[model samples]
Target: MEELSPTAERLVSEFVRTTRRQGAVPSRQVADRTLELLRQLVSEPGWRQTAQLVGQLRAAGRQLAAELPTQPAVGTLVCRLLKMAREEHGAHDEVHEARPHGAPPSQVDSLHRRLTAGRGAAPAADLSSELTGLRANLLAGLDELQTELDASADNIAREALSHIHADDVVLTAGRSATVLAFLRRAARERAFHVLVVEGAPFGGGHRAAAELAALPRRVHVTVIAESALFAMMARVNKVILGVHTVLADGGLRAPVGTQALALAARFHSVPVIVCAPSYKLSPQFHRGDQQEGFLESVSPESVLPYADGALVGRARLTCPLFDYVPPELVTLFVTHTGGTSPWYVYRLLNEYYDQQDHEIVQV
Candidate 1:
């Protein structure tokens, strides 16, 4: 397998290290970083052919995935880049296939031959032109991916007013950039109260509440404990949460306390809305037989600080960083494309992630 270019190596290393250390690095950032690394790989001079470049990208993507096995976005971005490469390669092959048998080589084909044979110190004009075009197409695809990443939140947020209303109490758990943006967007048009569940062991809900309160709209924010979810359900009009991954079966992997919130909302017949970008939709199913754990377990110390070995050893603190919320608990999904039902999430998965890359181990 071809090695990653120096620049690609550096970019991947930093991203992997940061993600592993920080934990819960936003999916958007991970997609952007992966695309940036791909852009560099496409432009690197060491590649002899498009196929060679694709092989190297796959190798680099595997390395990135290995560094963070729980991050599906990394693998998703790689699959996208691979698709682009395949498209270009297919087009190039078609052009060659259309050539008349035993005909004189086209100028571009001659240049390719010369470059392959190492007959010149520098590439010919036509070879340079072809390479430039290929690089532009790959870079353009990456740029489009970046734009999609940047705009996903705003696109999803645009549907907020349709779901939220004046005096409605929207309950959510933990810190979700998607949920926060959706609420803030709705708050601009409607006055509402937000009940944030303080997802303990991390207390991310406190930070989420503060950020929501900072919005310019008229909104009331309350930070409540996870234990209080059922108590608050009767007053809540809706539950809006964000997901770490949208499984193929339409279930979600969310911050640890999400399952409780969803269950409570269901008990009270409160609608649960999930805000997610298309990139978070994974093609893999979370069925008992399938492997869909992009979820990670945090340091047990976060649950019970090292008071002493005597106490620490006595208690087995199992703190999973995320919880699985079945699709049955979710009423609707707000995506970049618009609002969809939980069952429709399967379509979004088909749109974003390729079947071939569904298994990260194989991809």
Candidate 2:
């Protein structure tokens, strides 16, 4: 994986290898799983084992777009290419006033004119070939993305947890596993209580609270509304949440109330913590230095009332769906490998992408 294009392939392969060893996935299914995982993995800076594909976008200009989208660097590359095209065209047009008397356009400028001209605006054959290559690379990379994602998740969950003393309130939402982790350690000494929230709409918090409730008597379950969660923040000592996206500026995109929750906790002097697998750590981010998040929604009918004809009625509906919590609000991220802050995530991306720099060439 010495080239930009190969980054996708290498990532898929590495994820497959890791997952297969963990028994999290089968060998036969690894290929297909990795494909879907890489596409998503490259879009965030959460669980990446390598660097942030910073220069991988150059592949598009190198005529590798045909196979670049699915590659680890394709997402970044496509974004870069789009911006590059705009920039290059902007400069070209700015300097494109009628040629000075007797002055001929530069060779490159002449080619540009030819490309823009109707008679030779573009080469259909070349374009067709490039498109085909792009599709091939995309599909190839998608094939391994999923497997990598799941496997990476499982592997990250396997890391041993250090003990956090009792008389502590761990505030967390989403990822039932990480919460269980904190509770498990608490159960060892039987002294900690847990304050959980319902990640409404999807409400992963409901699931989390339930799981913790059944974990013995020491873990207390506090199911609070999105609004009330902030008001009750002073009671907790630690805040742990999940990451939806790791933005470019070393921030995180978590559930909506998470930022509010984190902020409230911060006011009370709480040491917030996040537990996740290392694979969830990625190097891909955009829009300034901050991480971005996409709030997934469910069927609209979910909000419909169950009262007579109410569910099917157009009169009333209730669904706020999901929200993104910025990383600045996060205190520490706990991965199976270890716990670290968002700033450390940047270095992880650098390392991962560095390994993938040359090896990530498009197929």
Error of 1 at 227 (Å): 0.9
Q: lDDT for every model?
A: 0.76, 0.49
TM-score of 2: 0.52
Q: Against the true structure, what is each candidate's TM-score?
A: 0.81, 0.52
In the range 82-118, model 1's lDDT, one tens digit per residue, is 7676556545654567766776434444455557665
RMSD of each: 9.1, 14.6
Candidate 2: Cα lDDT at 190:
57
lDDT for model 1 comes to 0.76
